[model samples]
Target: MNLVDQGAFRWHTLWLERANRSNYRKDGQILNKQAFVSLLTPPGRGAVATVVVGGQDCVACVAERFDAACGRRLDELVIDRIFFGRWRSREGPGEELVVCRRSDWVEIHGHGGRAAPASIIQDLVEDGCREMAWPDLLWQTSADPFAAEACIALTQARTQRTAAILMDQVRGALREQWEKVIRALESGDIPTASASMEELTQQSCIGLHLIQPYRVVLCGPPNVGKSTLINALLGYQRSIVYDQPGTTRDVLTTHTALEGWPIELSDTAGLRDQASGVEAEGVERSRQQREKADLVLLIYDASQSSPEVILTEGSGQQHLTIYNKMDQRSSGLDGEGIFTNALTGDGVGDLVKAIVETLVPLPPRAGQAVPFTHRQVKALKASQVQLFSDQPQTAAAILRAAARVGPVVSS
Candidate 1:
């Protein structure tokens, strides 16, 4: 039999068993089987968008709006099968899309844009499926907290490496590690559990940044190549470039991925004491950006005298000093700094590598257990504390609690 038949047979058997024990009708009708619809893909212009409709009677609801290209009705489509078709709306013809039927769900792959997905969702809603946000839908469908988090993070992943790591968690990498720790605790292996918790806790620092981009701010005295360098790094002219000082009077930000890690680069106004009004405001904002940035690039013109005071001021923060216009004669200054010519894109590649290394000292390996949320970190820390207190049972309890799934509701 086909996959659909197999799924139907299994579902029918389970339904019958439940019916025998409860209020399900003998006519094969399920009670209180509410259908829900959610947009599985990000809402924006893209190559494709996925809309998921699930629960009992969802197939019948989708069947009313879907017309298969092969002349097959939606209910006639087999589970685990893909059908190319046109999704119709109440007004007229809608966008052409691909629909996949599953045991308890239907996935609609449609053209990605504001109107197409919205139209499809409206059609589904009109057909009696309740609309739900993706995160809430994910939380409801996932088997565990780790799986739910993995599903949510997968959507925001900016690189294949990050996506692969989340996929590992979804496939039980972190869950397996949690089980190991629990088993170790049950067996009175405090040291083993403690060691595992410590390692995973340390890795959490990097894990938490997987879905969020690192903020890198460029700050320096006026007339330095900060704007030019930013343009070169982004491979586009996002910041206004001019030879005059104070050309960039406000913070200009752009996002990009460096070495498969997401990063947001900010070009700030040059820092100087002699400023007033708008220029002073920009300088103040620049300082604020430097204070909060994950990494600050303190730039100086290689041909000019170094500002030792600026470097000293930025020393307290995580920063890198870069000497621009290396094509010109080097200033007789002595200190550690990267030399580059933003005009020619010289040394930019080395600069990118340095940024990546500084931010992510040790990239996560595939299948590694890393905590991505504050709750997970707190749980790990609690387990560690219990592990050292001669409380194996308590530690085991904490470990299980850490792995427990919590309700995630959308705001």
Candidate 2:
């Protein structure tokens, strides 16, 4: 069975934080570490940026461009001391920076949210320091590719939910999970190995979504207050609400968190048989959004005399029936759907909780092992399939390769 159809591995993140420690050592590349420069921290603007200069001549290389304000030479500066200084460059006047000497490397902390760090890195590279991407440089520190990948994936984590899970893998939970599979295979216990692999494979729905949030699309017939429902869920006026039918003539998407898990909510154009021109195109897009959504909210105008006529909606899609504008409705809902007054925000809380539960009914806890990438999921499933088939031993071999290699392993 294809358990996860549209990119949900069905896992949670408490382990993503386990892999942030810097080990800085890899095999056969010790000699290459002699003179190198890299942005040790994640790219983009932040409070501060850290540029790492390491190797045999790292001290001299940084000293040539940096001048200490205390009149102390770079070589004579105390190790680990936060010395304030100016990093000189030929193009223009330099900016104030804080340089700290480590046992083997010097960390240059400078103004972030600007191009200063990149400029300094470029100058260092011209100074004969080899430049490397943060992940490739990190890969050299540990032979454990899983931990290395966890460190890399941590940078892209959108929510704490995802980062925490990646951290778990970095702290050895990810590798340990696979080690169990390998041990079972080595013992000739096919059942144990296959079951374990399948569980991780099943977790792909949650695991893969840690970085990529699940897309929840709001859709229904025209003038059903779809805009109001989306605004109520988002706690703001994101979608334009109006009395006119097709106000939102396009798919409007916004990122939000439902019970801590990141989810993308889409306010799409209403579906109507009479829509034409741009409105018709929008209606078509709304249908397309429903087809791709992780969850579809089939909204209904509770005030309408014939709300139940559209009951047989959203064919072949997982959806939740919601009765909106409840206060305006004349008759009782008969407990058929979740009732809400989108304009006043009544019953929205229950709807939010329901959406989260529908997507991830059982969230993964701390220390739980999960496959956080598509390649990892594919590898687990392929291994499990082979374990029960002709390639019995290939399961263990694949798991080993996945841990050794980053992200996806060749199955």
Candidate 3:
């Protein structure tokens, strides 16, 4: 697939429907709002448009607008059977209007026009149909929004690893983890509980490792083959490699899979003590990127002897030192890291393996308790912090708060 053609071939239609309910409460508790979803996204210009509505009054509201093509009224229709119909506006006097209604819901199968669906939705809104955002609709009625989000994420996720991990999470990995922890707590097994918490934390971190790409920044002195190392790992010419010291004037990025983990690898300008002008700014930016990176690959050319390369203080423990040009005469340095000839693609796989090891240390169990959102993680951390603090009651309160974010039964 061409990156340039991404989303270009499709004639996109944007939905601007707002969540609406009778008596109008956005909190969703005042009235169980009917929810709608579209199966087909624009690009295929299919003749028919299908909108699915879900909620308490979905079937009844839809039945009112529908006249089944088979001479069946939606009010007397079966739950799963499709009724062919021309929906007319109830507010209007006659059958000049058309919309499709189903059991407890309505599907307006109209001509695929730029404005037809919008016009239909507007008609529904005018007739007191509540238009709601997909998220709000799901959250109000679904058992777990995180699980639903996970399902959606799996559908859109790019890689097989991502799809697999998200699918498992949605299937009850997090719930299982919570259940194990709660069970241990109920059994008065404090040691088991502590161990379970630690395991849960590790599982959560691993889940994050699965879904999000880890940022790995390359840093080293000028002319140490930092760009060369990046190209070697990526197996493509992603950056300009030059004999000159400051060839890479800005940070260049390329993404690749390291083992099963996704990685965002950055090749930044060489860090040096002094630079004339823009190169100096580039060097400062390189330092900042290094500090922010999840992993830093510090490169040093084996040919260079004067200024020994070492990681700066802010570089994380995930940092790996690359000794490039290892084919040259030995500089007598030895370590438990990669020694590579970036020019020839030798030992780059070993470097990638090291990165994968750092990113994902183990195969996470299918049903592990992993926080699916940053909010869940934050709440869990807050609970853990409270647990460690002197106030036991406060810690319980924090746990309750975290429990509120998910389901209390899981907590």
Candidate 4:
């Protein structure tokens, strides 16, 4: 695939999408809500537009506007089956459509133009159905906001392993754990709550990455085989590899999985004492990115004397020193570092293992509670602060709100 074609996500590497559902604060509640209509697709040009309506009267409302091509009324249609139809608008001519009927909601699929979907939504609103934004629609449809977020995260998940970890959250691991925290608080067990909070905060390193791959930036002086190493790890030619110094003028990124863990790897412009123009800018950007990266691989030429480890303060980034081009060593060397030949793919597999193990030391297991969003991690930390401050009640309230289980009575 061309790098320029995937311009936006290519360099960014499918970064995190913040799924903060703090305001809703609901879980395991009855799904009954006022009948609402929403256009799931954007009101712009597309192939097919989807409008979902849910409530006791949702099917009746949709049936009024639909003329099924199979001569079957929605009442006779099988649930989850997409029936062909025509959406006859009271104001204008009808449009071709295919709609699926579900247990609680009925989806109307029609022309993805501005006029057709807008007309249909307006008609539904006129018929006493509430008009809702797509996000609001999802919030209302889901029973638990935390699990709902997990579902959303699962949609963007890159690998089956990550998806499995996230699926646990969707299956009530997140909500159940928060429920435990709230229970401990209600029962005045501050110690237990604090310990759980600390553990979950640590899990944020893995939980927050359920959808986004970890940011792994490879950096070193000019012509140290950073590009070749990244290519070896990715098993493909993602970065342009050249033997000349400063060949990579910008940070080139690609996403790949190692040991079922998704990682976004970057090959950056070589750091050098003498640089000019775009090379200088690239070097500056690489330095800035290293500070923000979860893991930074400091690549060095294995044939030369081992370079001094660069010490960066307060960046909180884990640094792994990599001795590259082991196949071309002038002499044998001894050191505590990952040795590899990016050109021949030697020791690259061990390097990949180390990268994953460093980033995620303890992988989430089945039935484990992993707070998989910023909102969750923040709430956990905030509540821990409250507990530490001797305000058990406040901590309980915060956990309850974050869990979306509403307020619990403190015992």
- Best-performing candidate as measured by lDDT: 1
lDDT per residue as tens, model 3, 69-179: 767767676654555556566455333234444333444556554565655566556656677644444344444445555654453455676667776766667656655
Compared with the true structure, what per-residue lDDT tens digits does model 2 show for residues 309-334?
Answer: 44335556677889898998756445
After superposition, the stretches of candidate 4 with alpha carbons farther than 4 Å from their true spots are: 1-35, 39-50, 68-85, 90-104, 109-134, 306-314, 405-411
Q: Is candidate 2 or candidate 3 better by TM-score?
A: 2
Model 3 sits at a Cα RMSD from the real structure of 6.3
Q: How much lDDT does candidate 3 score?
A: 0.62
Q: For each candidate, C-alpha RMSD in Å?
A: 7.5, 6.4, 6.3, 6.9
TM-score of each: 0.77, 0.85, 0.78, 0.80
User: Candidate 1: misplaced stretches above 4 Å?
Assistant: 1-33, 41-51, 59-101, 106-128, 306-308, 311-316, 329-331, 385-395, 407-411
Query: Least lDDT summed over 10 consecutive residues: which range in candidate 4?
Result: 11-20
TM-score of 3: 0.78
lDDT over C-alpha atoms for residue 95 of model 1: 77
- Indicate the worst ten consecutive residues by lDDT in candidate 2: 5-14
Q: Rank the candidates by TM-score, best first.
A: 2, 4, 3, 1
lDDT values, one for every candidate: 0.77, 0.76, 0.62, 0.75
